[model samples]
Target chain A: MSQLANVLNITKAPQPSCQAQRLTASKSLSARQQQELRAILEQGLPQVAQPYLAIAEQINASPDQVLAQIALWQEQGLIKRFGLVVKHRQLGFKANAMVVWDIADEQVDAVAKLLSSCPEVSLCYRRPRRLPDWRYNLFCMIHGTDRAIVEAQIAAIVDKFALQAVNKDILFSVKAYKQQGARYTKKGNCHG
Target chain B: MDKQSRQATTPVAELTALDKRIINLLQRGLPVVERPFLEIAQQLGCHEDEVLERLNHLMTNKVLTRFGPMFDAVCLGGAFTLAALAVPEPEFERVTEQVNSFDEVAHNYRRSHDFNMWFVVGAESAEQVNNVINDIESKTGLPVLNTPKLEEFYVQLYLPA
Candidate 1:
């Protein structure tokens, strides 16, 4: 398959059944409720015995309502995952690298799947190349507590995938200016 | 003390096995129920209060940067693209400040590469995404190579604590 066609095949989101559910959910919640929920969630879930009840009290909604809304949102895919967002740095994962590869068009998908299954490989995706300036098409992220370990993992990944001849680059992050959850709804307003 | 000295003196908080377990469980996802903590505690064979306490401690210690619902900006009618700029070594800091000045630029990272500065720009529309890239180029006077995901093969991270 062509590179574009290969990408298109995997880029497809969930089927229509899930999409229809998300659409129904998009209109089910009142704008005011969504705004209030978004505001509370943006602050992060409060750690308490009854967290939902706490949210309910703050939003002036019932506990059941808050729980139901969150459940619905998760089902709709509005909320990708609702849980603890660990600071990798704090978890001793100080060394992280974004490895980009110019895999052959036909083998990109198979290579991506193999790379994604690697224990050290955290994130893998296919991005378009910028031609003369940028040539790598496949990207994967590896995180380790030390720089050397991360580099070793990358070397192993290349060998395992038989990408010896492929052009690749490993970009280790030197600084992080900003990293936070995507804010879809404004703090006070539901609409962005 | 100066900023550099203060950072050097601060001790890194250690993670216990229980803390690791908590992180592992939470990463999978918090149960969608009225008393999710209770369920977690039950599974871990601990009390609900203990689970709550550890979570509170983790948040306080900054082990977990956030703990809540993660929204997909694209699904919510927003556009997001990953772009990078090959900034000159001397002007890197100034370019970083200029690029980060825009509200649309969500995550910016200084990576080791010719195209060194990488960031994600999220906006309400495709037009805004393009505009942000243009604005960054104008401000930094560097060519911005936009490499938005043509396709996402698999996007997930499961870091075992």
Candidate 2:
């Protein structure tokens, strides 16, 4: 297999459908720090106002140093938004779904901008149209209390914006076998 | 990972090389199964305990938002749709809490626009998904706009080093 093929193979090759790029990234991190970082994040952040300082003390570093480094990572976009990852179903908001929009090639950017600006649209992205069978460029999410409410909101969006010409469908989630962050714990062990 | 590393105050705006490396590691997500941290530690050259500790710290401090599985709604089943509501600024928080009260709603956030309120709704079945939308419309007394997925595509937001 070619190099690219090899990388993509992981996602395809794994019995459980693992993404290969993850392994490749894990390989980049040396053994020691990866281990340490894993432990820290899994254990959860420290308590107290200056938690970083507490963590620094545990890891034998100054709080300032840790903060400075974290700042740099954010600037580089290595770290996405940092917040709480709650159990939606546990919270009683069980229904999960991804809504794709068949935005006019010309109106994609505009529509995406408009859609993304809404808070409920947690994640929005631009994707290439799947030729022959699929063709959608704008994607966003809408989560709410109930189905009717979700539909009502869609109706409102159509009315609010003259998107009558747009082709859209709601792909509701059947089950969420895996709904968490992408794993990268085995970067080096799996022969990258 | 040390005490400093556990501080949740590390904002995304100011990260360092080490921070970048750590964040990059984190974005990859947590491994499935027991002792997942051990795997990360083995690769990163740190103790398994250290990795877990650091993850806890980051999560506690708010430097890392969520670290868990993100489902593929299409494969999972049920209807997946996107919708937005025009929530005024003054009512954003109240509306957000009201919207969040529903269990099907996974994530709730605020955006900048007349239709400022956006959220993701998941259901056990397609019919349930639609029903949830309908309920939202009635309760809020506001129209629910549905922008379902006509075509599906995988999205990975990994920035280049």
Against the true structure, whose DockQ is highest? 1
Candidate 2 lDDT, A21-69, residue by residue in tens: 1332233334454345435644444423345566566666555555554
Question: Per-residue lDDT tens digits of candidate 1, residues A25-92?
Answer: 44445667767877788678888878888988887778878777777776676676666656676666
Candidate 1, superposed: residue stretches over 4 Å from native? A1-29, A177-192, B1-11, B153-161
Q: Estimate the lDDT of model 1.
A: 0.74
Model 1, C-alpha of A176: deviation from truth (Å): 3.3
Clash count (model 1, backbone only): 0
Highest-scoring model, lDDT: 1
Model 2: how far is B13 from its true place, Å?
32
lDDT accuracy of residue B105 in candidate 2: 65
Q: Supply DockQ values for each candidate.
A: 0.51, 0.04
Question: Which lDDT tens digits does candidate 1 get at residues B1-161?
Answer: 75323322444569877787877787667887888899998989998998889888988898887887766555656777788999889998899889888887766788999989888877777798899899988888888899886655444456455
